[model samples]
Target: MHTLRLSDEHLIGLARWATDRMARVERPVLAERVLGVAGHRIQDPRARADVLTAAAEARLGLGHLPRHLTQAYAAELQCADEHHKAGHRKAAAASAAKALILAFHRVAHIDGLTSPLATDPAQFTGPLRRSRVLRALRAPRGRVTASAAPPADRPMRLLLVHSANDNFLPVVLDHYRNHPGVEVRVLDTAADPATAPLAKGLGRMIASGIGIRSAYAGQVEEALRPHLDWADVVFVDWCTAAAAFLTLVDPGTTRVVVRLHSFEVFSYWPHLVDFSRVDDLVFVSEHLRDLAVAALPRLREPDAPATHVLDNAVDLARSPLPKKPDARFTLGLVGLSQVAKDPRWALEVLRVLRRQDKRYRLRLIGDSMEPGVSPALDRYRTAFAAELAPLVASGAVHMTGHTDDIAAELTNVGVILSTSVRESWHLGLVEGAASGAVPVVRDWPFFADRPHGAHSLFPRDWVVSTPAEAAARILAVNESEESWLESGHEASEKAISTWGWGTVAPRFDSLLCARFAEIPAQRRVRTIAE
Candidate 1:
């Protein structure tokens, strides 16, 4: 079907018409629906964005489109900055939040928005722009009454919040969800693809820190208020935007707890979070806790919540069977969806081990490294594939792709390798150990200079500083079937006693169930205009 071609001026006029209609409407719900219809008719990227300009006019508008379409929208944002300069702090904050959200959307990964935390060379880097944006966002002024603190015998209402990565929380979720003493609710932000990525932007957060209370506070309150009010104690599973969104408002009397897994310390989210609002901050490892505290000095502040290092929950009961007699020569590494897993390091170690005995084979039991996370990650995957291709063709490397049942996957493996440069805790290594596979953990380089890292986390004998050392350790354990079996048994026991959920759940209970409590009104987290 041939469509009539429209001039640029005509398209711009259509966008203007939509924005005019948006201004006339009261509720944004209707305007948003109407704008989307107009946007759908525009095949050109520029025209699509022109149509989106109408949506940005709403108080909590998020103009998160591809960067090309943001030009006309930028003019609207300038009005926000103009308002801010003219002392309309709240309007400026809202405008900045909408603009930043659109400008920094994760989908705009080509040039400027690739690294959300990195300072852009083209943009001004004054501190208050970030501080001003955050300050303008504000919080709920009236403390909504949360469910009362349950007695020792009653269940504590626990809400679990995570953005997209909930891999570490499964066992913990199952435990509390089934526990008679704790009631549970989980909110996976990624469950809704439309709004999920929007949470990743820091513009609203920067506005929040800017200190001028904003209309954004009311937006956050409206989205999260019900969950906040329902829970007695909210346990946010990751130190992500979901966690920050929960703390954006005062928890009223409900206690707030946040778990910091490995990667978040490298992001700006931790720095943006107001730690004084939290009741407890949990970590998967002490090394991560130390890194977070050092990364965000605010955690050391007097009102910073109590911190605890709870191991990532693992179910060891699934892997109790003995390995095959020849399992001694088998090496396994699981979960390689990120470049950081450094599968090439494991390959290097395999090459060294295979030189001594042709029987040695590496079993990679998860998805391959994801390509195109960025140009750097894509390059890493390309190089890794070149290295891996010949090895797989030679039968020295076995690619299992992905698996739902890791217990069955590790059964043939005798040695587990942790080649990551950084980790709060290596769950795959621990699980391998539980399955009677001896672990050879690399001294994770990110924290090698720190007081504690992989060396402190695992047994000295199990930790290695180099691929040659890893090869030597594997050889030492697998010299004989008897020696390998005995070593595997010892690793299995240690894995179960220490990191397994049977033992670790009690530690979580002490932190989430025991110490969690209602905050006094005087010390409650600040709302917009205290």
Candidate 2:
């Protein structure tokens, strides 16, 4: 037997061949792996030149490639062109650009990639203009204006700003979606190009001499003025980028309510928010409220709006228990994507369970967060992956990525686990409970010692300090499948009846009505005119 150690050129050639083969087989994972290897090989100048030549040859001979693969090759060529341009290698840069243009043309014929690159006049300098990505990502702005008369006798028009894909949005939307006295509009702040870009730009520039009030202040004010004029109340979630943008807009007569979850208080966005614009502040947990108050001095201002603690709404009606005989021994963590969720702790508890009875298995739901976003999260993610790799390989742990139907996923999971270090409210835990999974909370580290923690929110027996304790509780509950099922049934009943959207909707209505009544009718009329 002979072992081969391939040169960079050989590796690049092999990767290209593998990619072509994988694309023919319609295996995205294999194609992705080949692309990764090709990317690594292209780090060497000689190898990169060879790869570009190979790509050009492939284009001429093969005629066309997969859309994704072609795009990847074009991106690699563009990166090579950038490196050449940085080094003033005109010839090399021109070669790379030619290759990129050829690859781009091949893929442009596919659906969703048909925008001609154009030079931006605003960014022109010294007889040259930069070609920005002017494709499908750009959003078309429509004319938005203030409503004429508060939209059908609703006490107020309320805009709730939230992330587009968060699990929390559905719950929040359900609470106020059809409230008679409040017309609620759920604006996905993260997806709004006009406001999101300005907000992000302001955040990056604030560290420099640029005035925090000047960066996106005018843009936000202009974009949101009409909406604010129409809305008598605005609720901004996360007290981070979304809240800061709302404050910058100056809501005029519209009262603003900013909700601070556990993560935002640790970020710089809270400091950037103009507290004077907010009419009220809501926190999911009292400990979060205390932390924000202590961390940000503005919250302590005598004139600051009243702060209230409200639990996150859950549409428990949709969560129904599933049938599984061995479910009593199956411990599940509904969300394991974030470091805050602490999947490793859950793994430790599973280890303890397996020691007692090998029938124990752990299920992890939700995809991991992108590590490029935060250093703290990246470290935690690395450690978690390392811990789970062996357990997963042994078939003791199961991973189900993002799912639309968690209630269905919880069918075989008897014990729901929350090992997070922090939480605004563990919606996953609550939802799991509603699905008939017995809740096992880890006594969130961020507020475990505080007067108001998981201990106050859940039953005493449900909160545990360590994995061993948690494992012991699970074993005791699982001594008999009938008893375990009954306990989970009770938990589900309590969660659905108490935290369901039906009960939470009225509270949202009351808050909006009270805020609207406080606004003078004369000012309301003027707002309508504006």
Residue-by-residue lDDT tens digits, candidate 1, 131-188: 3333343222323443245566667888888887887788888999888888999887
> Which candidate gets the maximum lDDT versus the true structure?
1
The number of clashing residue pairs in model 1 is: 19
Cα error of candidate 2 at position 88, Å: 38
Identify the candidate with maximal TM-score: 1
Whole-model Cα lDDT of every candidate shown, in order: 0.68, 0.62
lDDT of 2 by residue, 123-233 (tens): 111111111111100111111232133444445677888655355666667556665566777676678766556555432323211122343456666767777777767
Model 1 lDDT on a 0 to 1 scale: 0.68
Candidate 2 regions off by >4 Å? 1-155, 163-166, 193-197, 203-217, 369-379, 515-530
Candidate 1, superposed: residue stretches over 4 Å from native: 1-148, 151-154, 192-201, 208-215, 515-529
